[model samples]
Target: MDLIEELMQEITLNNFDVGSSTWVDVTYINNPHSFYVRPTSYRSFLKSMQAHGQKLEQQDLQLSMNIVYYSKTLKNFCRGLIYHVDTAKKNCTCDIYAIDYGCVEKSVSLKNMYSPLLEQGLPPLATHCQLANCEPKNGLWKDKEIDAMKCYIGTEKAKLIVKGKTCLKLIVELFNSCPDDIATMLALTGYSTLGYNENVFSRIPNFKQEKHYYTYPKIEPGNVLHVRTQSGKDLDNFYVAKVDEYYDYINNVNNLLAYSKQAQSLRPEDMKENKAISVFVPQFLRYERGIIQKITVSEEKALVQLVD
Candidate 1:
């Protein structure tokens, strides 16, 4: 059978086509209205990727870039496309785009690449979908909206009611145990605004899509000064401790900066109860863990409690 036809047949069997209401795992949420889903029983599509994937060597990176390859990104092998190759060094790494999840991994090593099978023509396993007839109030997504969706959709399976489809993505409404369903719950709680007429996830603006690389401190000898050690063993392990401290300090500062930036951009209306956030405590003089307990937009005040 033709590949597309076979794929459609499987999608129908899984009840993932339009007018099908099935339980799906809400995997990744790009925004309040945009998310990715995997049917509880995705079936043969996953099995084919796992059973037919073939590993490749460093010399095979160029040829593998043009086709779908299995990338061992940690534990599970992901079907991805290598978009760029870093060939300046002897051992090259590539930037890979995981089609199913709609995410990217940079500087991936050659060992992760796996050549595609000759007959591997199926759509991405994770279906790109969006909440039907719903959008954010300000025409943008915030951390709160994303957080709300995560809370509503927890680890349990979500109901995907496929209303229709666009040229690329499915127009759907996701529902949990909430009385109003995901869309109505968001709207009632003010996390999202209603009146969206079509599938808008594709047209919605993504938040902070730019990527930046940082220069990390090397742990090799003579790379950094201040070599103090109590014994030979301590001396040998000095670089490791130093590097760990360097990363810890960098991470802490970055966290503080990110929190401050997000906080500044937020209005009183954006604050929601039980929303996870980082706050600068005057007594501690550093960013500390906190959860918003109460929001009073009229008073421009929120009661936040620090938590472990």
Candidate 2:
């Protein structure tokens, strides 16, 4: 099948149905935490309020339930799109049924509310298993930096859970292809045809070598393979390149490493003088085809060696 077809199929299978116009009044909310809402679930809740002989407005009734689903699109550039039911809204923020629901919808809309406490419940199936099995502590931010990012990006626990599951799935799927290495596989995922080049993985330096490495003897069905650096450093600098391109990149990095070593040996006197030498560094030393360009360095010390 074509790429579009494949994407459509994936969306059809994984995406949820908030319901149709006939059965549900759906509206999109701006808050990343609660992106969409369906009015159908409110039917029963609305009846309960009326049955109690409480002369509350329909908008008021909707506000009382405050059932809004959080949206996940706003967290990060590559974060997944997710939605969660937010009970605090007491009304759909989209004001979808303004005529039918009235001012109560406006009052209880998510826009007017502060971030609510995520309802404690079992996360969706797609998220629960992956999150439970995550390497770092469950529900804990990977680091203080990540926690700070969450706060700055206005991410809530619900959105984070959604984004985490999405990333995990992407990781799992890319690993399934077994495209020679992580860089090649990542290129296919469109993360970057180029492999990682910077200290992007500084937050989880050992993540690539230890956790993300794809060095399994055999990739069993239902099992994933990962590629990690030998030194347990971050893999964020690695870029995803096509398989064929990665082969060339591998050779280039090897050649550069040899040249770097030769240059260092020749300049032992310069090294003793504490002066940086202008060595002929290949622009594509670490080229991984479309995966990564090169690891550019002006420093005399070479910390990374490109693996063949």
TM-score of 1: 0.53
What tens-digit string does per-residue lDDT give for candidate 2 at 190-280?
3223322221222243434323122313446886433312233366654332333332232123223222332324332223222222243
**Model-by-model lDDT, in order?**
0.61, 0.26
The stretch of ten residues in a row with the least summed lDDT in candidate 2 is 75-84
Clashes of each: 0, 43
Tens-digit lDDT string for candidate 1 (131-229): 887778887888988898888888888888977654346778888787877888888888987775544443465588433222355668657553212
Global fold similarity of model 2 (TM-score): 0.17
Q: What lDDT, from 0 to 1, does candidate 1 have?
A: 0.61
TM-score of each: 0.53, 0.17
